[model samples]
Target chain A: MPGYRSEHIVSSYEEELTQIAQHISRMGGLAEQAVASAVQALLKLDHDLAKQVVAGDKALDALHRGLDEMAVSIIARRQPMASDLRMIVTSIHIASDLERVGDMAKQVARRALQIEGLSLNPRFYNGVKHLSDLILRQLKGALDAYATRNAAEAIAICNGDDEVDALHTSLFRELLTYMMEDPRTISQCTNLLFCAKSLERVGDHATNIAEAAYYLETGKQLSGDVEELQRVQHKI
Target chain B: MPGYRSEHIVSSYEEELTQIAQHISRMGGLAEQAVASAVQALLKLDHDLAKQVVAGDKALDALHRGLDEMAVSIIARRQPMASDLRMIVTSIHIASDLERVGDMAKQVARRALQIEGLSLNPRFYNGVKHLSDLILRQLKGALDAYATRNAAEAIAICNGDDEVDALHTSLFRELLTYMMEDPRTISQCTNLLFCAKSLERVGDHATNIAEAAYYLETGKQLSGDVEELQRVQHKI
Candidate 1:
């Protein structure tokens, strides 16, 4: 009787979990596209493309809200406990971070619309582009960690956020000098600076998601077992 | 015996909810002060004040993270069902937004540190300062809505975010002209722009919290309700 009840319950729960994971993956894909387009819009001064990014952000926002509704329904209907409940709850937090990341992408695109066709130093754009790329990679890695239930990979990604933060600081100072030297470049420089900040924030949200994934896979928190994770992460 | 079990559970849940509310209020107070000091730091170009603002932000960040951990534990241990779960989860989202609001305040302070004794147009600083004030008020109103279980008030506060956005856009355009005209004004103007954007974003995060509160109280989402909130916000 115990075996029968447990089998039926777990099978139904797994079905819903699969559906939820698919939705999250869909949302993540959209977020990545938004970030890339935001950077492209900035470099090209493409207002049309920028507008598209902003408009698409509404969809991301809706997806986040919709996913939360679904997760709540799952919790209510399924009565998830222990690790199962953690997974669903973690999705809710991930949704919030993803929505904010979408907003950041929108902010960058809006700034692009404001300062169009200005010649920025190639190195400057390159730096911002690199930051975006790194953030995108971290986001992908976090999603993979979720799929595989790999807490070690997730913890490693969270620690990588410090690198993103350092890159942001370096880029901020570089942009500051550009505006400091030439008044004409100030508007464009400020916009790009904000764009870099936005990307840095996206990296942070990714780290948050990674942390959530780790919490879901393991009943422990990385914050509590930092030393353990640090040692294990290095070996991995 | 059934009635006694129910009563004991209800009272215990009430006690935890009360504690959560108190902690959020305390965090809100710190957030209000952070925004205020960051603005003052920019207006006065006081690096020491800015440094203090930065330090204060770290504490605010820690408080936000701590509150989130507490809320999570409450939900996990208490196993809040239905609307109770939603409310706790919403708190987690609100804490993250508040933490980022603290980060933006630190960003403003960091900009202040870069510029020494340089004063910009009082009009510009006043606009940003007023915007921050409005956002703080909105955050307070939203939190009240949460504590009191008032959906309409939360909706109203969420709508107030538009005014802040409009002010930021106007300030950005005006500041651009000033920077474009004078090289020496670029650094100060850039800092002012950062403050303005930070205030605008703070308002946005406040609205997000209001939305979460509304969802928790009513268990109904007025999708794209922000549009309507903006229309009714004038009365507030």
Candidate 2:
């Protein structure tokens, strides 16, 4: 009977862990939707859709608060040690990253609203669309890695950040050239620059999530490879 | 004897809390120094100083990790509830914000390096210097509020973010005009725009810290006032 009671306790703890993981997955899904909606809103110049994306951020924020509170409560109640503790702590970290991703999406939506009614060059629009598509792919891949506990996949997603940075740099240079070519395009290009920046930040938050996943599986921080990439990009 | 033992436990808990607070203050000082140095580097076109600022971020990152580990360990070992738990959790949040503040400073430093040897308009330089000064003031005020557990002071700091946003918008417009007026200035102005954005982000992080302070004291999240301000600015 004593052994049976111990087994019951173990199962209960496992249940709680499963619940936290589910919450994180749900939060990731919401963040993914937010990013996709924001990008589509930008491309279609849909003001209503942009407003919807902006309004959706509150839900993401609330989910983050809920996940954080749950993680803290589980720690206090269960006193989870080692891998279990790491999982809970890393969930909190990933939730924060997801919340920031939501904010980035909202910023894009706001920029889309600001640029409404301005006739922008189609090439600039195509550049932003392409960049956000790459970011969205990174976001999805990182979330998948988190769900599967795949550190290798997470590292791959992180390495992809260099490509995102390179794209952003080229887009920035292109937009600058556009503005310099015709002063009339300055306002629209400026808005586009901000949109590009928001997408770039989304890629950054995705990398943060991937790093969290790597830490969760290995109980170690990812090395300085990403930082090295950032430094190299900065030099350029 | 029981009463005395309880008092001793309370004192030790207070000691742990004090230690965490001190770490946060130290981290904030590092972040403040980094931002000031980066901005000075930009104004003086000091590549070496900018490199120093970039290197300084690793220390901030290490401090953040130390603070986070301490907070998590406290939560696990002490099983703190109510205000004690809130304080520890909020400390973690504030540390993350400070670390990101350090990143923004590093970004400014990198931009300074990219624009080396280019003579920018003195007006633009003055504008960036002024913005950084305001942001640094806000950061210090927020830190003070956290140290004192003064929710009112924290709220005031959060409200000050709107002014930062307004200053950033004006700076953006002015830089856009500069780029338009002289295509030769495009590269320098673009770099300046990024620096302005970085400073603006530092202010946003300050507001995040202030909000965490308010939450620590009141056990309630600050309302949507800051978000409302953001939305209004987006409309502009």
TM-score of chain A, all candidates: 0.91, 0.91
Pick by TM-score: which candidate is best? 2
lDDT leader: 2
The digit string of per-residue lDDT tens for model 1 on A1-236 reads: 99999999889889998888888888888988999999989887899999999999989988988898888788767766656777777777787777878988998999888895777578887888788888999988888888788987898798888889999988988887888787677767887878887899899888888887888887666666768767865874
Q: Each candidate's DockQ score against the native complex?
A: 0.49, 0.46
Task: Estimate, for each residue in A1-236, the C-alpha lDDT of model 2 and write its tens digit.
Answer: 99999999999999999999999899889998998899899889899999999999999999999988898787767877757877887888889999999999999899989885766578867877788889989999998888899987888888889899999999999888887777777777778788888899999999989988887776677754566445544654
Shift of residue B69 alpha carbon in model 1, Å: 4.0
Q: Which runs of model 1 end up more than 4 angstroms from their true locations?
A: A1-6, A218-236, B1-6, B45-49, B226-236
Q: Per-residue lDDT of B141-229 in model 2, one digit per residue for the tens?
A: 99999999888788788878989999999999998887787777877877888899999999999998998888777777776456644
Span of 10 residues, lowest total lDDT, candidate 1 chain A = A76-85
Writing each residue's lDDT as its tens digit, candidate 1 over B1-111 gives: 999999998998899887877877777778778888888888778889899989888687678767766766776677677777787777777777778778878888898
Pairs with backbone N, CA or C atoms under 3 Å apart (clashes), candidate 2: none
* Model 1 interface CAPRI class: medium
